[model samples]
Target: MPRADFPTPVKNLIAELKRLPGVGPRSAERMAVWLLQNKKAEPTALAEALVLAEEKIISCPACGFFATAEVCEICTDPKRDETLLCVVEQATDVLPLERSGAFKGRYHCLGGKLSPLDRVSPEDLLIPQLISRIEAISGEMEIILALGADVEGEATSNYLADLMRGKPVKITRIAQGLPAGGGLEHADELTLIRALQGRRDF
Candidate 1:
């Protein structure tokens, strides 16, 4: 019979890794073993990187997207059109749209959508900031609601539309009947851009 020995520290590391999203127990154990077997300073660097990311990275004040500094790169970019703002649920949702090379407007990341069961309220999102920005815009701007076509997404779009009533801005929602409940992060770049181009008024 062969005896097995497992260190407490290694077990702790594996458990911690398993806590991460999409990382199962087997994958976590493999990662922990890899970290131990690798001679380089990668494990230490990985720990440092995780700590740094959590401590330094913050939500952009204006857009509710991730930003290392006070403002996000897109918000500070002068080339983007201020007269147009595309509203999305998460920060990663912007990538597909950006890759399509179709949109020339700015983005407002809501951080998340309206999910009552998830205890997500409008106050929990960046909706107030969006309204303030709309009010402050010197000229009429077009608000493009780019949320997914899920039930919650539809509710969010309707809420925003009602909020923008009497405002000088034009409100629009991305086209439907494509892929309902599909996240922008998962959508192909061409499809997302086409949706943006074919947006309909809300």
Candidate 2:
């Protein structure tokens, strides 16, 4: 039998690294070796940061974005246009939109998209919370669906539009500058700008 290139600790590190999205076996192994070769404090610092984040950080009660407090900073900001609400899938999607500087509105994270094949339904998302938010505002609010451009996203958008048909709020969807099947994180600033500017009624 061939000798193992890694010891038990290194093998365990590689396994944990591989659990991260988009990291393959080779990449995880390389990361494990690099972490070990570097100063021991580097890995220790990384571990400490992860542990602290997991311990202190939590989903915002109002918007579903990450927050150390009850509500996220964006949701609590009075300057943000309360009449405009942007809806996205994951909490990470909020970062890309904020980075684009194209929107000055608050947000509602859906937790995930509706995919019947994946067995994710409307009830599985934070849709009830979203409805409560709209009802609480109940004053000329507009909902912008900033979701992925995949089939699932389209279906979800259509479903949401139908659901909001009787509501007083205006519903719109982000425009087509985003590439097909791509999420908000994949879009550049200019793309996001155009999409936001060219949004149409749903």
The residue ranges of model 2 lying beyond 4 angstroms of the native Cα positions read: 178-202
Residue-by-residue lDDT tens digits, candidate 2, 5-110: 7788889999999999999999998898888896754988899999999998999989999999888899889899999999999999999999989999999999
Q: Name the regions of candidate 1 deviating beyond 4 angstroms.
A: 1-5, 39-41, 177-202
For model 2, the run of ten residues with the poorest summed lDDT: 32-41
Report the Cα lDDT for candidate 2: 0.90
- Tell me the alpha-carbon RMSD of every candidate: 5.8, 5.6
Q: Residue 67 of model 1: what lDDT?
A: 91
Error of 1 at 161 (Å): 1.2
Scanning candidate 1 in windows of ten residues, the lowest lDDT window is: 173-182
Model 1 clashes, total count: 0
Candidates in order have lDDT scores of: 0.89, 0.90
* Number of backbone collisions per candidate: 0, 0
Residues 168-191, candidate 1: write the lDDT tens digits: 999987664347777887877667
